[model samples]
Target: MPTKQEILDLHFMDARYKLIDLAAFLDRVDRHSGEGDFRFDALKAALPLLLSEQQGRAKAVLDALSDPSIEPIEKATTQGASGAPRPAGVPL
Candidate 1:
């Protein structure tokens, strides 16, 4: 389960995705036409939401990491459990 902070972070990330999408759209509009009023209006409307998401995003991330449900994975070793040396030229 995601903690309170984790949930917040996830939401922020999702909002960031929206911001990126809008920005890209605006860029395209600009490249194609100087009078791209619609794109600008859309971006302006999205600004507040994006800002709010970014503001609380960091705290949300910390909360997520604190959750016990999350697990840490370790990379496997080339050698066996006994720590025996591997043959030369073996790829990791």
Candidate 2:
């Protein structure tokens, strides 16, 4: 088993762009949202695609962020419509 710091550094510290790549995404979300509701909502939204194969890791990361001691603030931005909705600038 990897040490916690190793797991964290490998999964979160060097991640880029995508939330699934980062272990801390949930923690950040929890710290920024002021509620677990939003964090779990975001996780449920993302899980089908990003965490399907790594559900345990995803759950662990999310659970860690659920601590009441964490703060929450609204995220500065959100992704455009998911599924078939293409982001701006990409030809449909």
lDDT of each: 0.51, 0.51
Model 2 lDDT tens row, 1-92:
99988887887744554645455766676578455544355455555554456557755555444433344435625554322222235342
Which stretch of 10 consecutive residues in model 2 shows the poorest summed lDDT? 81-90
Q: Pick the candidate with the highest TM-score.
A: 1
- Candidate 1's displacement at residue 77, Å, is 70
1-92: candidate 1 lDDT, tens digit per residue = 88999888779888789769968976777688456343245335445553464677545444433323334327655443222222335333
Each prediction's total of clashing residue pairs, residues at least 3 apart in sequence or on different chains, is 2, 7
Candidate 1 local accuracy as lDDT? 0.51
Off by over 4 Å in 1: 1-4, 38-92
